[model samples]
Target: MLAKQRYNKILELLDKDGIVHTAELVKLMGVSSETVRKDLEYLDNQGRLSRVHGGAVPVDIGTTPDMPGGYISLQIRNSQHLEQKSAITAKAASMVEEGQIIALDYGSTSQMMALTLKERFHRLTVVTNSIQNALILAENPGITIILTGGVLNRDEYTLVNDFSATLESIHIDIMFMTVTGIDPVVGCTDQRLSEIRIQNQLHQSASRTIVLADSSKFGKASLIKICPFEEIDTIITDGGITPLMEEKIRKTGTRLIIS
Candidate 1:
C-alpha cells in the first residue's frame, strides 16, 4: 500500500496495543523490515510515537522533548519506563542493608524501590513523604513506615511540607531519592516547587543520598533545582546513560552506578 496508508495502519496498531513492533508491522503491512524501520523512524521524528529497540511506544505522556521536565501524573509516569526503573530500583534495593532506616522520596522510581525493598529486606524502617511508597511497604510487619507530615499533593501523591523539623530527630541511613531531571551541570531538579524544601531536608537527614534516576532523566534541567551534584553521594540509573554524561557525572565526585 501507499506510505500514508502504512502510517495510518501503524498508528492504529499503536493506539490499540500502546506499542507496535517492527516485525509485527512488517507482517501486517506486507512490507519489508527496512520499510517498517523507516516508517517507525518517520513517526518518531514527527513526534507521533517513540521508537524503541524492537518497537515503537506511545509518545511519552505529560512531557515534551524540548522541555524535558514537567509535571507528569504518577500513573502516567509509572507506566512509561518500566524496565529501566525496575532495573534501577532493583539496584537501589541491593544497596540497602538489613534493618537500616532508609528514606524514600516521592516518584515512580522510588515507589518501585519500595516494592524491591519490601521483597528483599525483612526488617527495616522506611521513612517517606510518598503515600504510595508508604502503602507499598505497609503490609510488611518487619518494615516500619514513617510518613513525613505535610500537605498532600494529590497529583503526585506526595506530601509537600517543610520536613526539616520532622527529620531533625530521625537518623536516615540512606535516602533513595528521585527527580524529574538530572543534569551533570544543573544537578537534580523536579517539576514541583513545593517539594524542594522537603527534598533538601531528606538530604540533610540521611547520612548518604542515593538518587534513583533513569537514563532518560539525564542531561535535562527541570523547572526548579533541588540540589547540586556535590550534595549527592551517588546516583543509580540504567545502562541507557551515555558515556560522556557518565564521565561528567563522575567528574562531579558523585558515584555513578549503572544497573
Candidate 2:
C-alpha cells in the first residue's frame, strides 16, 4: 500500500481500537518495518496520533508516563488503587466462562478478581496460590477452589515450591496473573524471584494468559522478569495507562482493555 493508503488504514484501525500497532500496520499495509515506523512518525508529527514506545495512541488519550515507586507489601497494596483495581478486575472477571478451569496468581488485584468471579458462573474450578483469594472464593458454592499445596509465603499469603501438582493435574482454560511492573523495553516483571516458578508453571499449563494490573504497573521495571509482554494474550488495566505504554502493547498485538 502507498503512504497515503497506509496512513488512512492506520487511522481507521486507531478509530476502532483506540490504538494501532506498528506490526499490524506492517502486515496490513504490506510494508517493511522501517516503512511502518516512518508512517507512524509522519502521523505523530502531524499531531494526528500521539507517538508512544512501540506504536501510537489516539492523541485524545493524552497523559505522560508517571514514575512508579518500588514494590510494596500486601498491606500497602490493598489500600492503594482500591477503585482502579476493582474496576480492572471486574472487567477481567467477565472474560471467565462457565465450566472453565481458571488459574490465578498472587496479588491484591488477582484476589479482587477471584472475589468478583463469584456468582458469575454456575460451575468454576479455580486454582490459585493466594490464601485470601481461596477464602473469598470459597463462599461461592458454584466455584471449586483449589488452593496450591506448597510452601507458604507469609508475607504474600501465597503457596509456592513444587507447582507440578497443579500444572500436571488439569488443563487450565484461562489464567490471570499479576505483576509488580510492566515496561515496553523489559516486558512483564515482578519483585520476587521465588514466585516466578509457580507462575511460569501456570503460564505453561494454561491455554490463555491474561495479566491484571493497574496503570501503576506501566513505566516501571521490576527486579525480575517473569516473561516477555508478548507472552500474555491480553491485559486488563485502568485508564491510568499512558499513551506510550498503550503503543507498546499494541505493537505486540496483545489486546489492551483500559477500564
Candidate 3:
C-alpha cells in the first residue's frame, strides 16, 4: 500500500482498538517494520498520536480546549507504564481484606488492583468510578461491584459527575486512589478538575486512604491539586521512588510501602 494509505489504516486500527502494536501494524499494512516505525514516528511528530513501547496510542487533543473533554485520551497517552503499574497494584491488593468495603479510583494502577483483587478476595464490596475496573470485578462472585452513576468518560472508561457528592454520605473502609503527580510540598495533583473532585470526595468518605503511584509520578504536579499528603493514610509505590522523596512523604506521618 502507499505510505499515505498505510498510515490511514494504522489510524483506523487505533481508533477501533484504542491501541495498536507495531507488529500488528506491519502485518496489516504489509510493510517492513522500519517502514511502520517511520510511519508512527511521522504521526507522533504531527501530534496526532503518542508512541508507546511496541505500539502507538491516539492523542487527546480534545483535552486542550476547543476540544472535548479528554480524560480517556490522556489516560491512553500514559498507558505505557503497565509493568510499573502492576507492581503498584500488587502492593495495594495486599492491603485489602475480606468483608471490607473499598473505593477504587480510575487509573491504570487502580485497574491493576482490581485485576489482582479478582483473583484473591473472596468476600468484598468494591465501589469504583472506573467502568473497566467494575466490569472486571463483575465476573468474580466473591466480589460485589458498585459503579458510580454519572457522565461516562469514553477514553478512560470512568464515571465523573454529581454522583461524587453521594460518596460523601456513604462510608467506606478504605480507598485505593491514584494520582498524576505527587510532590512533597504540593501533595497529590491531577490534570482534571472533575477527577480531583471525585478523588477528594473518595478520600473524605473512606476511613483509610491509600495513594497508589509509581516512581515516575513523583515530583510532577498537574493542573489541579487533589489533597495534601498529610490527608492520606498511606502511600504504596514501587521501590524506584527516591529516598529523598520517600523521606518527604514519611514526614507527613503517612506510612510508605515500597514494593
Candidate 4:
C-alpha cells in the first residue's frame, strides 16, 4: 500500500477505537512492522497523532477559540478534570527545589501546585498574580508568598490587567503556568488577553517555563498563542498523553512528566 494510504487507514482506526497497536496495524495494513512504525513516526512528526507503547492513540481535542470563552469562574473550573489535575499538581510539586523562586499563574491546577509546594517545601519564595494562591500559601509560614499587584478578575479570583513591579523585578527560578489550550500547531494558548499579557511577561522573566495542563488540553488551541513548543521547558500532565505527543515533546527536548 502507498504510505499515504496507510497513514489514512491508521488515523481512521485511531478515530474509531482511539488507539492502534503495532501488531494490529501490521495485520490491518498488510505491511511489515518496520513499515508501520515508520508510518506512525511520520504521522507523529506531523502532529497528526500520538504514539504510545506498542500502539498509537488519537489526540483528544476541544474547540480552539477562533473566538473566545470569556473569563471562567473558579468554582466552575474546580469541577473539571479532577483526577487529571490532581496528578498534574503532584508531579509539578515533586520537581520543586526547597529554596528556588517559583512563579505560579492563576488556575485551579496552579492553586493545587502551590498547596503542594507549601506542604513539601521550606524557605521557598513564591510569587503569583492569583489571590487564591496568596491566600492558600499565606498560612504556611515556611513559605514566603509574594502577591503581584494587578487588577482583579473576580470570577476567577485572579489579579490581572495590570503589571506588577514585584513580578518584573525578580528572577523567577521556575514558573509553573496553566493554559486553556496545549496544541502542537498552536503551542500554549489562552482565551484572556489580559492574562496573556501577564503570561508573556512571566514567560520572559522566568528562567524555566513549565506548563501544568491535563490531557484534555492536548490538541486544543485558544485565542492567543503564548509560545511555541520549543519555548516551554517542561510539561507536567496526566498519563493520558498519547505516545505521539510524548515522542514529540521528547524530540523538542521538553521534559514530559506524565503523572
Candidate 5:
C-alpha cells in the first residue's frame, strides 16, 4: 500500500477505537515497525494526531479554547484498565453518604465515581470541574451539582485555570481525586500545572481527601506533583494492587481500601 493510503487507514482505526498502538499498526499494515513509527511521526507533525508512549491519538479530543502555553492535548489512547477503574470507582462511591458535600476531580476514574454515586446517593452536593460528571448528575433531582467556572479543557472535559482558585472558599466533606500517576514516595501527580494547582487547593480545603486510582497509576510519575501520599486521607484501589504497594501506602499512615 502507498504511504498515503496506510496513513489514512491508521487514522481511520484511531477514530474508531480512540487509539492506535504501534505494534497493532505494524501488523495491520504488514509493515516494519520503523515504517509504522514514521507514519505516526508524520501524522503527528501534520497536527492530525498526537503520539503517546505506544500509540497515536486524535488531537482535537478534549481541546480547550483558551489553552495555556505549550499545552498539548491529553488523550488516553490505551483504555486497557477501564474495567479496573470502574471497579475502583464503585468501591469508592460506596463510602460516600447522603447529605455530604463531595469534591470530585476530573478524569475517567472520577467520571465513573460520579456515575455510581448518581445511582446510589440522594440529597448530596457534588462539586466538580468535569462537564461529563456534571451532566451525569444533572438528571438526578436528589443531587445538587456544582461545576467550577474556568476555561474548559476539551481533552478531559474539566475546568481549570484561575477559576479553580475559587474552590478555596468552599468547604467539602470529602474530595475524590484522580491522577495520571501516583508514587508511594512522591505522591499524586498530573501532567498539567493548572490541574496541579486546582488539586492542591481541593486537598487543602476538603475535610477528607480520598484518592481513587487503578494499579496502572502506581510507580508512574507525571510532570507535576499535586500532593504527597501523607496528605491523602484514604486510597481506594482495585484488587490488582500489589501487596507490597499496599504496605508502602500503609506505612504513610493513609488508610488503604482495596476492593
Candidate 6:
C-alpha cells in the first residue's frame, strides 16, 4: 500500500483496538518492521496517535471544535475528502425520491448531499439543523428548506437545541447523516454531545436512516456514540472502505452501500 493508505489503515486499526503493536502492523500491512516504525513516527508527529514502547495508541482528536490540534473544522473536513464525499453524496442523493420529506443532520458530508439533492430534484422538503445546508438549498426555488430552530453553534454551523419535540411531530421519509467515527463495536459516534442527541432523535423520527460516511471513519470511535449498526437502516460510503471493515458492519445486520 502507499503511504497514505498505510496511514489510514494504521489509524483504523488504532481506532478499532485502541492500541497497535508494531510487529502486528508489519504483518497486517505487509511491510517491514522499520517501515511500520517510520509510519508510527510520522503519525505521532501529526498528533494522530501516541507512539509508545513498540506500539502506538489512537489520539483523542475531533472531540471538541475549539481545542487546538484536536478539533476538525467544517471547512477543513469539507476540503479533505472531496472525491470520496462527492461519490458518497451522489449515491445518497440517488436514493432519495422527489417530494419526499428528508432530514439532513449537521456535517460536511450532509452539506454535500444537500447540494446533490438540490441539483437532482426539483421538489422536496428538507429539514436540517445545518445553517450551511439550508443556505445551499435555499437557492433552489423548488426545494423547501426547514431550518430547525435552536441555539446556533457557530463553530459547527449547526443548531444545538433539543430536537425531541420538533422531530416527534414531523415525519421524515429519509434522513442522511454523518458521523465522526464508525468503530465496529461502538457503531456510530460523533464529537459533539448535542449533535449526538439530535442525530438520535432524527433517527427515531425518520422512516429510514442512512449514514453517510467515508472509508476513513470505519474502525474509529468518537467521543459520543449515537447507536449501534443494527439500528441504522443503511450505510452509504465510498469505495475506499476496506473489505474487513465492510464485513464487520455487514455482520451487524446493517445494509452497506459502497458509492
Tally clashing residue pairs in candidate 6. 0
In order, the Cα lDDT scores of the candidates are: 0.83, 0.80, 0.80, 0.79, 0.79, 0.83
Segments of candidate 2 deviating more than 4 angstroms: 1-71, 163-166
Tell me the TM-score of each prediction against the true structure. Answer: 0.75, 0.71, 0.73, 0.71, 0.73, 0.76
Better of 4 and 5 by TM-score: 5
lDDT of 1: 0.83
Clash pairs (backbone) in predicted model 1 = none
How many clashing pairs per prediction, in order?
A: 0, 0, 2, 3, 3, 0
Candidates 1 and 3: which is better by TM-score?
Answer: 1
Candidate 4 wrong stretches, greater than 4 Å: 1-67
Better of 1 and 3 by lDDT: 1
Best by TM-score: 6
Better of 2 and 5 by TM-score: 5
Worst 10-residue lDDT window, candidate 5: 62-71
- Per-residue C-alpha lDDT of model 6 across residues 143-212, encoded as one tens digit per residue: 9988777888888888876744677788999989799889889889887766776787788889999999
Candidate 5 is scored at a TM of 0.73
Clashing pairs in 2: none
Runs with alpha carbons beyond 4 Å of true place in candidate 5: 1-80
lDDT at 37, model 6: 94
